[model samples]
Target chain A: MTANRPLILLTNDDGIHAEGIRYLTIAMEHVGEYWVVAPEAEQSAVGHSITLYDPIKAHEISKNGSFYGYGISGTPADSVKLAIHSLLPRVPDLVISGINNGANVGINVLYSGTVSAATEAAILGVPAMAVSLAQKKNPPFQWVVPHVERLALWLLKFGLPPGVALNVNIPAIPPEALRGYKLTRQRLAKMRESFEEREDPRGNRYYWLSGEVPIEESDDSLDATALNDGFVSITPLFYDLTAHSHLQDLATALKNLT
Target chain B: MTANRPLILLTNDDGIHAEGIRYLTIAMEHVGEYWVVAPEAEQSAVGHSITLYDPIKAHEISKNGSFYGYGISGTPADSVKLAIHSLLPRVPDLVISGINNGANVGINVLYSGTVSAATEAAILGVPAMAVSLAQKKNPPFQWVVPHVERLALWLLKFGLPPGVALNVNIPAIPPEALRGYKLTRQRLAKMRESFEEREDPRGNRYYWLSGEVPIEESDDSLDATALNDGFVSITPLFYDLTAHSHLQDLATALKNLT
Candidate 1:
């Protein structure tokens, strides 16, 4: 590896002013020269969306240039695409998305903009990692930062396989109580659907979408299972959605249709 | 299967007013009892996004009692969630998303709202299908609807496996010129990224994200590859994003960290 410092591109779904990004920036301060580009508003569940119809406005937010940061009026995926395609000084060595609020475990990853930003980078042939706290509220970043920093350094040193990005979720407990990191697969925990019907001021009916997350307590060492057990979960995620095992059966089924 | 009509919930990424959804509604009228709840505006490329922080507005747009449709002020995934949670009579027997204006093939499926809607239904243990045309401009749905109807009927007769959704991309060409369907995998197609910089009336600089899709030709029979060969592609997509092959390697890599 070159002696030169790596160029790290940082982004998140919780908006530019989120506490998670601030803590994440502080953690990466000593490791490499980094640039931060994130959405201006919270885009939490906006999974892999790119803003195509609207013009993107990117405003420089950093004053002293300690970390060149820009707040963009777009989705998390849009920020990553814009930063890598137009803003960065070359392709970044690494892309880190989030110190996100709440755990992106199991089926939640499919709806996570935090992981989507990292996935976008990985699809473009960059090494990427997405980190999340296992709570809805702010967790103790002091303990989480060191683990993230250590993982970042290791990734920079060893390098990740192409087309794969790590989805890391840290438990929201004290360092002493935490069980460290465990590499796991995505579990099947899903948010149960609940809608609240309400009448708007204009006398029109509207519905608010809300849900409760069901606990998945299978014996498998999946991300949700690990996080539920108070263990930090790290899952390697891929962009390939093809169900390879079912290809033959699907082919046979289509043959009958023809 | 019950002698009663199957309840089919319909939605799309192109909003409730798009021609694609209208055509799909007409086609579905013959097959089952239908209910439509879609976004109020186009929500293309929005993958699996659900509106969590904002209050959603769902308004009934259709007066015809035979066809019930609601226009939602949220993403496609949100519409699906709202419909299932509050709008539908019960859990829908099947969910059909899109006759989207353009094809959602290969890795593009990762960023597609059309496919994500189907993925949401599949995740909820319902049979689902996401259909799209290979055209960019105003597509001729007359030719495409027959194939869609046939496929939809076949799927209803022989249900899909749980947790799997079929992503069908029909060639834009006439039905006569089209070859039979091919059960394919997701291919990696290169979309060139370039920004168009322009000054607004206020002299503020902004960018429009623009890119060209490169011709993707792969030996493996993937969705995009099949489309390029003038064949209809039927890819069985799953919501599981875990890279199963890399789990062991990641486990070994993180063993010491714990």
Candidate 2:
């Protein structure tokens, strides 16, 4: 690790104008030479998606010394890809996504555009982290910025593994009131899905996709549990989705399918 | 599995108007009751993304008896979610996506909307399959329909595991001349990314993302290799994404970070 300032690529699932990304940008400004390339619209739940079908439009919003910001017409993953492949001076020393509006814990991480942005960077061999606040409604982010800055500094000092990125969810509490961080695992929480079937003014039928996340916490000290218990959680996430434990069983079961 | 006719949900990334989905619908018409709900426009490389920010519009496009279709204004994953949660009579006996325009083999699967639809269904505990052709241009799909029907029938008879899906890549050769199916694994060949920097007529600088997929055959029996060898390839894919092999090593390395 170098004592010189690290080049950090910052992004989020929320649009560039969101309070979450703004707070994150403020936090990261003092730590390193940073570039922000985020989506123009809120892209929550866009899991690992990249823009391929349409031409992406990137507008430069800021270009000062050691700092740059561009709002992209794509997803979080697209922002990271565009930054790395075109916009940046070089491959960034680290990629940090979010300071997201809500906690991306348990199976939620699978659906998180914030985490997916970080994962995209990690897949290309850059160190990365995805940070989120454990609240659905926007929380006051000023107090959490310092903690995020500190964590980012620590991660820069001690680099992450090549294909691993940290999924960090901080409790929405004051710094003094918050408990310390814990390395945790992902839990399986059921996202109860429901639909609101309605008719448009034209008398045609339509449905609104809506779901409620179960607030029930399990006994394990997983990411969700830590957030529910008022502690900041950091879960290491990877991109290789192979279930090695089931490989042998699958091999046996699929033997006859051939 | 029941001896009765299977209930199948058919979808694709090539929108409702593409010939690929039309051919796929014809193939599955005999296998079971078919419910087709696909994106209204091309959603090709939109990996595992779902629509949350916008109101989803689903319009019924087919009126054939026991054959229903919907045109959804969402990604491939969103189509599947809408089908399972609200549109279908019950959970589908099997979920099949594509007959997509190009091959979704190797690392290309990570960015494929076709495979992500199947992955979403698999994560929800449905038996799923994602089928694609190894051709960039649209080939005569009439010959491929019979082979797809056979594969679908086979899957309906022998169900897949809870969280796994078969990514089937078919050779574009005529069905009569093509070799038989081969059970294979995902190849490691990645699309080499190259940025084509361009200037708009209005004098704004932007980039058009372009990349070429190198056809280096990693193994003779891998998914990409099988398609290159004139055979259909069926690779079982899972969604866990945890690199369990490196978990212990990662834990040790992460412990040192503190």
Compute each candidate's TM-score over C-alphas.
Answer: 0.96, 0.91
lDDT of 2: 0.80
lDDT of 2 by residue, B120-174 (tens): 8887788888989878785767867987788788778778777888888888888
Candidate 2: Cα lDDT at B238: 76
Cα lDDT, all candidates: 0.85, 0.80
Q: Which residue pairs come into collision in candidate 1?
A: none
TM (B chain), model 2? 0.94
Clashes of each: 0, 1
A1-258 per-residue lDDT for model 2 (tens digits): 456778898999888878887788799878998888999888898888877766788887763553458999888988998899889988898898987877888666777899999988887778898998877685778867987788788788777766778888888887778877767777754467766788889988777777656557776457788888887777777675544455566557655555
Model 1 Cα lDDT, one tens digit per residue, B124-145: 8888999999888979877778
Model 2 C-alpha RMSD vs. true structure (Å) is: 2.8
